[model samples]
Target: MTDTLIQTLDVALGERSYDIVIGPGLLGSLSQHIETVSPTARIAIITDETVYELHGQAIEQALAGRQTHIIIRPAGEAQKSLANLEDILDSLFRAGFDRSDLLIAFGGGVIGDLAGFAASIYKRGMPFIQVPTTLLSQVDSSVGGKTAINNQFGKNLIGAFYQPQKVVTDTDLLKTLPARQLKAGYAEVLKYGLLGDPAFFDALEAGLGQDILDLDEAALTKAIHVSCATKAKIVAQDEREGGVRALLNLGHTFGHALELEAGYDGDLLHGEAVSVGMEMAFRFAVEQGLCPVADADRVSAHLAATDMPRISDMTHLLHDPAALLKHMGQDKKNESGHLTLILPRKIGETFIEKRADREAVLRFLTQLRDEA
Candidate 1:
């Protein structure tokens, strides 16, 4: 249980395999991960306003001797937009970023997602490192190379599975994060347990206490390392979300819909959405006879213990179930005119299912508002 630091490796396909560094004091060691694969022209650190305040200069200072520019956008999920991309590109150009310039994501999932997307498309793909500061990003978003932005359609609608050169997980940075954000980020951490490994969930449940107000370096590092390894295996087999990787989306289908309805406001953090989404997915599966009601309840209890949102509160985001369903239909994961659902067959086990009937989904939505 006293895992202060650990070195783990994940093999991503296409000549892009890399190691994940997890431990305390990682923020200070970020420079080690920034690869000079080729001659680099410049460096750009893209993060949101909030993250920059926390470790912007620390990261920039890590690359201090190099040519670096920092792009700090206003904090919010809505910031992930074509407009923001354009602004970031402008900043990169102003900072003299060329074909070989590097981009490092120094925030939670949103910033990591945005920075990765920017790196992938800029000048026909540039180098980028994931310096994920939040537990959610460290464990989930920053590891997989899945970069994206949102739109009128839904969350992460526009994105690519572009892998990062290195994932720098500094658990130290998490200590300064607000408790609410910390709890919200743990949703994704718990996700690895929900989808693939039940043991990790048990560890998280036992380790995460009400007084987790301060970061326990050992606990945080273990969670991040395990989740990253899980993602690495899934990504290795199916880097483009072909099959096994879809398992990672256990709560995302339902979660993304809620985030869009909330307009990516600070009100619904990504981890919060996923936590509730995972619960809803399980509960909906139980409703459809795909799983037991007890399974759904257990999922709810785990999320609640971590201070995550509840699926029963879906109605709070909106009044009409049809509207939410409509949003779900627009999800990128949907296929062949039928929405896909990642449902849990039981607690600690989930899978992607396409058998969810439309009426059943709508009926559930009609009741979501009441729960909200």
Candidate 2:
């Protein structure tokens, strides 16, 4: 629980494996890690305006003597687009950065995704590091090799599985995060528990949830470590989501649909959408006889207790079940025109239902809309 305590977890991918270093005040030691991974590589730090303003000086001081270029974009989910990716690539080319150079994604999920995608395709390929500042990015996006940019069709429609050279998560940076964003990130933390660890879920329900939301050092660190450890194990087992990795998308199918309906206009944060989506997943499972009503109620109760978003809180965006269904149809998980959903058989137990009945999904949405 001390600020000096650091925990390291590895995503074992044979030749591509890397370590995720988690601790408070990690930025101070970032340069050493970077040097170890890309000692002779020139650096390009890609960050959004907000993050740069908040912690730019610290990062600059950390890598003081290293050759580096800073690229700062406007902060928001909207920035994760093809246009921005092109702009970043252009900047890298203009700066004469090459495959041997290093790129650092120095913000939340958006920056991580955009910069990561750029690194993936820049001159065939380039090594990159993730210095994720936000809680959401630290625990989830930063650990996975899934880098992407959004298109008009849907979220992360264009992307590649490009692993980073390293991930440095400084928990201290989270002190500046808005309460809402922090809560949003906690949704992903809750997710690892809901998806596979019942004991973790129980711990959350028993006050660990509030401890994390309150930013208690020990609690927050434990949550982050456990979430990343769970994800690392899964990614190592299935690097490209070929099989078990799909379980990580437990609430994402429904969540991404809600996000599309919200127009990605910042109205609904990704974690918030996932919060509601997870509840919906549990309820839908009950409807399908895959789970019990009691399990569904527990899921809802936990979200409500923690003040996380639920279906009732997002009624305005849930007005049209048909439209939501349309968005769901576009989910990347679909195969052969059949809906692929990650549904729960119970808390801590989830399975990929690749052949989900489309009409059944529609009816489920309709029922949710009516209730809302």
Candidate 3:
């Protein structure tokens, strides 16, 4: 709660710009922040059951007397569905909420995406705030304004780019996160480094990575700030993802295919799949002679040293290269019926290959399966 500890970064979107406030115990002063954005507007909070069970009372206390409506749903990646979206819309409509009111996405990425997407379309765009609780949500999803829900075809195919009015990131909440979930989120933290900053990657390789996994307050804070700052900068330059913003999805194409194969059943988390996908990207790059084997080996080594999920960890789906390739073909990044992959040139650098050879990718997948 120390004023000196709190840091705020801005996502510069001209008039739609918003602040991402990071620190511990910021939730204690949530009401004041809410007042600044939507003082007279009614508040509707959408969160998952798990998060509500842990922090429900604190949230109620934070918003003490603000005409609040609490909507809780069962927690899981599976919950990010069209059915849940409809249910949320019905609840908002039944509650008589209007476009001028404020909607708060009060959980991890699932709730944030669902609620933010709901807010974006409801009554032609109601204002919303992001109060992301998970490490993945805090560093990545919450700041980007790329709200979405999953579908049968792929993950996050149905959604919108609707920025939140404010993002309240309380690092303290991560204390209650299960270790597995925390590690899953760390995959995203690692991603910021892998995709762009070599210095950040070097720091992670040194000891900052373990410090973050250990939940060291200083390390966690710094990583979150850097990740958000990186994402915010990209989003500003390419608000609609016409250019640089796609860099943010370095491993998502392959990762989403893995998620699709897993059926959004909570068995394979987005970040976990992303960890494997990043490794695949590097290996794929090496196979294509675009990057050095040393770079790919280093990426694999770092992921293994951190105890992250790897391609080997997903042997169950490895047998079907055709299926995985089919999923990849449907990736949102694909254009003109061609596969688009984000491949690494080296550590701390990546490029979007728009016309990824379908057969080459299949051969690579077959090789992974054979090796597994």
Top candidate when judged by lDDT against the true structure: 2
Candidate 1 colliding pairs: 315-368, 315-369, 316-372
* lDDT values for all models: 0.77, 0.92, 0.91
* Model 3, span 1-372: residue lDDT tens: 867679999999999999999999999899999877887549999999999999999989998878899999999999889999999999999999999999999999889999999999999999999999999999898997898898888888899999999999999999999888888888888888988998999999999999999999999899999999999999999998877788888888888889999888889988898889999999999999999999899989999998999999999878899999999988878889989888889888988899999999999999999999
Local error of candidate 1 at 363, Å? 1.0
**What are the TM-scores, per candidate, against the unseen true structure?**
0.93, 0.98, 0.99
Ranking of candidates on lDDT, top first = 2, 3, 1
The reply for model 2, stretches above 4 Å from the true place, is 1-4
Better of 1 and 3 by TM-score: 3
TM-score of model 2 relative to the true fold? 0.98
Per-residue alpha-carbon lDDT of candidate 1 for residues 1-372, written as tens digits (9 for 90 to 100)? 124375656655768887777777767656655643434647788888888877776776677677777788888788889989888887887777776667878888888888899899888788888888877788788887888888887878888878888877777788778877887777887788888787766666675533333476666666777788888888889888777778898888788888878877688888888888888788778778888887677777766665577875555776767778888898777778987888887767888776568888888777666666
Show model 1 residue runs off by greater than 4 Å. Answer: 1-4, 35-41, 208-214, 312-314, 370-372
The candidate that wins on TM-score is 3
